[model samples]
Target chain A: MNNKLKQLDEQAVQYIAVGAAVLGTGGGGDPHIGKLMALEAIRKYGPVRVLSPEELADDDLVIPLSMIGAPTVMNEKIPSVQQMAMPLDLIEKELGRKVTAIMPIEVGGGNSLVPVLAAAERGIPILDADAMGRAFPESQMVTFYLDGIDCSPITMADERGNGVLMHAIDGIWEERMARAITIQMGGSASICDYPVSGAQAKQSAIPHTLSLAYDIGKTLFESKDSKQNPIEALLEQLHGYALFQGKAVDIRRRTEGGFTKGEAVFEGTDAYRDRMMRLFFQNEFLLATEEGKSLAVTPDLISLLDQDTGMPITTENLKYGARVVAVGFPCDPKWRAPKGLDTVGPQYFGYDVPYVPIEELAGGKGEKL
Target chain B: MNNKLKQLDEQAVQYIAVGAAVLGTGGGGDPHIGKLMALEAIRKYGPVRVLSPEELADDDLVIPLSMIGAPTVMNEKIPSVQQMAMPLDLIEKELGRKVTAIMPIEVGGGNSLVPVLAAAERGIPILDADAMGRAFPESQMVTFYLDGIDCSPITMADERGNGVLMHAIDGIWEERMARAITIQMGGSASICDYPVSGAQAKQSAIPHTLSLAYDIGKTLFESKDSKQNPIEALLEQLHGYALFQGKAVDIRRRTEGGFTKGEAVFEGTDAYRDRMMRLFFQNEFLLATEEGKSLAVTPDLISLLDQDTGMPITTENLKYGARVVAVGFPCDPKWRAPKGLDTVGPQYFGYDVPYVPIEELAGGKGEKL
Candidate 1:
């Protein structure tokens, strides 16, 4: 953690990809696809520079760029370099200035690294921060929205060369319009939104998330190298609780309304045999429940990790019969507030469950269910 | 017909509203609402100047502005002046130039006047032409599309102040994206598209359709004042055919896919008593049939008029019990061409009918059923 990253080398991208997947909590698109894209971009364009939010001058314009649509579609349709960079081109043209830095709108398996492709190609430094400390389903579920930042001049591009520039009245409107456009653009699109000033980024964005992802990725990788329990190491590193150890029994996923929506039911195994755990999601896992009790609910993190490799599984990749370890961690404090919970809480996603802190649901930090 | 309209005064707007309704063929939104909006804008500002395509310098930038969505919704959700002008503002900003002239994308009851609201407010001249000689449901059903003109830099605005600027690869893509946005904007939105040079306008645009509308409107009005049969005057003026005189016996309408679509069944009355006629539509009336024989199929024009007044009835305004006269006119020669028919013909609208000229179906000009 002390070794703050300065640039995105191939190794750094590999580590961030794993760490971001864990944070993605079974959404944010597939990590493997993002890692490959980031690697290819880095190999061709050289390493991308990473800057801390504080490093940005107050007047610098920082734009967060990522893919917006159903993760299932994104897994199949890889974006071209032009599609990745077109939003940046449009945003710059709209703002009439060069982007000072690029960053991810959310820290997710795919989104965290999506910006790397653009940053490397543009030769712009990537900010070591993101609007959402962890990935959430909707565009408005970001710290930027929590702080009432204007989500205007949002730009998007599909692989086919169709580009759109939108000025929404607010983040909610941005979500509605952008999602509709994404659906029309073949269910996936690269986007640049919430273009913020460095001052605004420093005030609203979750700081050092890229570095945090790298550290967590390094922990999992190092633990595996040393023949230690990688899942245990990850849980310890994140102060996360093991919600359940189970094998996926059923998963019902459908791509609708521009999102990968569904739920996965797991039959408890090993230490927690003969029980059931259910994880519900709309892109990002929003709630985990067992025996009618809330294990973890959104505004908190819920991740499903492969039991053997300790690698995270996205909602798109989680299949029946996969042995997995479900875990939970406290979300960024900004999300624990009333406004943040109201924006991304379980009820907002149409889940009937109430929002509960991961620690409370787990009966304390690092506890095993 | 000899007088070329140099300006749009209160009287000209009144005439054009009625004339455009005839051209609209029962789509293109309601003329009464358009008349009011155009009148309000003219009274607030001054009479809008009308520029023929020839009057425009070859390099002059002309943009077509109109309302896009289901006429059923447009009749209820009247757009504000800000909404009408926002697309013009956004398009000018996107293109980085001032718009030289404003024209209607389609010469419909509502669309023909929608541009005047912006042209008068911006002090720009209104062009006496439109891309679609008559209104069609989809955005791509324009002469410009048939001419292979690029339809990018399309801009849209909602009453809520949300604005979108899109660069579609083609006219079809523009229709897809713009329609989706219109649906999200509460089923109706003001839009500006097909930014063309005066040279392109002169080549692709249907010239003086506004003047044509004015003449038709004036003929109907004057004939009514002279105690002559207005419908007869209309039929003679346009060299149109009376398909059927009937009373609407059944009307089935639904707003779907960003269009007001359905069919009306009319029981023959007066001269054509004891017969039945069916008219099918998506915004504009595209087909009419009697005993499964095609009376008229699109790329031709079909309209329902009030038998008593000769004022055209919109698809949205047609009632189940109204007495009406269904008429047919040959569409612009451009629409009869292969590309134009392929784009807006009955087959394209899923009618399963071949395109046949109205003159052939009616057996001659000014014929009555």
Candidate 2:
């Protein structure tokens, strides 16, 4: 895609929403809610305008906004149009200027579309990029945070129009306070964080992430309908690997410390009948291993999907007795840096394995895509 | 106490600190630490000036500053001079003006002395009044909150020099966010909350609270030294009553939801033999009942003391088999109003009884002194 403005219709929104679920790695939050919001927003206001980062002027204020809280609470609370627009309204007043555009803090499930929902309400455009190519549990585990952009002065508002403005010294403090505030606000709140100049947006944001999610989603749908191998098409689009194919034997899940932590064990079938695969998740899927050996770990994308329909399975929805396939893909190159690993790597999630690209683990090419 | 400027020396600091402990009702924090800090500050700065609320200019900025978090953690953390000063420094930067004076958010235990420590560092006078005459579990449970003062833009700092600034809609939000922030900062932090102009301060703050605390402490010391009845002097000073004198038979304690809740039962002795007194506490001692009859309940002050020595006993230090006495005094008149009672009354603490003045329960005059 060139640096021209684009229009996002209902169809594009659905594709991007579904694709973001795949990248969510099981954590980001349900996409159905975001899809409904996005479609209604597009229909109510015309198709939202999507601008490439290069199209923004140097002095423009680009803010990344999304929902911060337990996905379980978010599911029950549901987003109201007013609640979605609240953070942006407060930010504009605090900054004493109109925001140029809204962007996603992370491209995962509902987060990828929350900015779209807010921007449509404000009659503003949405940016085509995201701060994190995928979602992580904490706010500080993003490229912007790693690159040392100030995450505040940040503003957030709950469903009741109660609001808080925070100026924190670092992104870790931002995540800590934001999580606490979300719980205080009855488990969910909307936030406008990581404000940056248009120039900084171009430098730090993961580029074309919306388009990437859209294409990834579109391909998955087409492959399933055409009776071709959906998993293979997904691997091709992401330049990734087909990690495993199996039937889920047992799934153990628990919500702990505000994140869903679980393990799903799969008995391999097809070409790998005797092997066993294990998947672990904390909000998002964090690790995939075969025979207790490392297959893939974050900050690499590891996702689980229904084997037949190729529907992405969220951490909260992972069920026993379902046939599934696990796919592994390299994350954005920005996530491979030392600082990025310190922020989002498997060790950051308390896993013991050193992070290796899925391509390397798959005995394929061992270079950046 | 007249509306005159006062200078606080080490001796005066000790009196005020001890007096504040009684006002703490039972929470506030350990007064010993506050006493030490106040003495150190007065020595280093050559005594701190304290002003009457009427002496301030209309435009003078008065900030209520205090220590927030678990008193247990605070005791271990042992605040550094820099940590205590950090909140003031950040607030000054946020306010864009030098604060004219520092006042305690609540004149209870250590909270009463924190402002004195900060004021000496900035070479500013301490305010003789406080937002709350005594400490309650939360920041919103203050007279200033009842009088319609916005609780933010508020600033707080942890021991590590990490800082946070929040703009909240009301004191409840302020308390919620500040409590969470304190926990995140490792369970103890310094906060500058409820910034108000001098005129507003006079209208809302409980007047001359420092002197009230000072006199309480001075008399307790004097009565003990003169071998006169300390309990009589204490009751006479506050126009209160000695509800019971007995031997503590049982004491049960636990920390719950950030507040300390406990029950101490004392078997009657002396003139109260064969009767029973029960003391229930949540941070502050909330109630005293004799034979299941409500003798004193918040927002009335209830305190426990060593019967023989007349030394004040904190809720945490209440011991079984120790001879003790229970004292009851009326809270500020502001807290007796319907709105104030609604905010900090016994009902707010989950007690079933309607609040009655200590004097009324004692079968004496019920009118406000």
Model number with the top DockQ: 1
Tens-place lDDT per residue, model 2, A132-166, is: 88888788988889899998878888877676666
Worst 10 residues of 1 chain B by lDDT: B360-369
Question: Each model's TM-score?
Answer: 0.99, 0.87
Interface RMSD (Cα, Å) for model 1: 0.5
Model 1 agreement with the true structure over B1-369: per-residue lDDT tens digits: 657899999999999999999989998878999999999999999999999998988999999999999998998999989998899889898888999999998988899999999998989999999988888989888888888889989999999999999999999999999999999889999998889999999999999999999999999889888978999888888888999999999999998888888999999888889999999998889999999999999978899999899989999999889999998888999988888888988989899878888888877765554
Best by lDDT: 1
Name the 10 consecutive residues with the lowest summed lDDT in model 1 chain A.
A360-369
lDDT (tens digit, per residue) of candidate 1 on A206-321: 99989999998998888887977998888888888999999999999999999999999999898889999999999998899998899999989999988988989899998889
The residue pairs found clashing in candidate 2 are A27-A283
Worst 10 residues of 2 chain B by lDDT: B360-369
TM-score of chain B of 1: 0.98
Kindly list the per-residue Cα lDDT of model 2 for residues B173-225, writing each as its tens digit: 88887887787787778988889999998888888889888888888888877
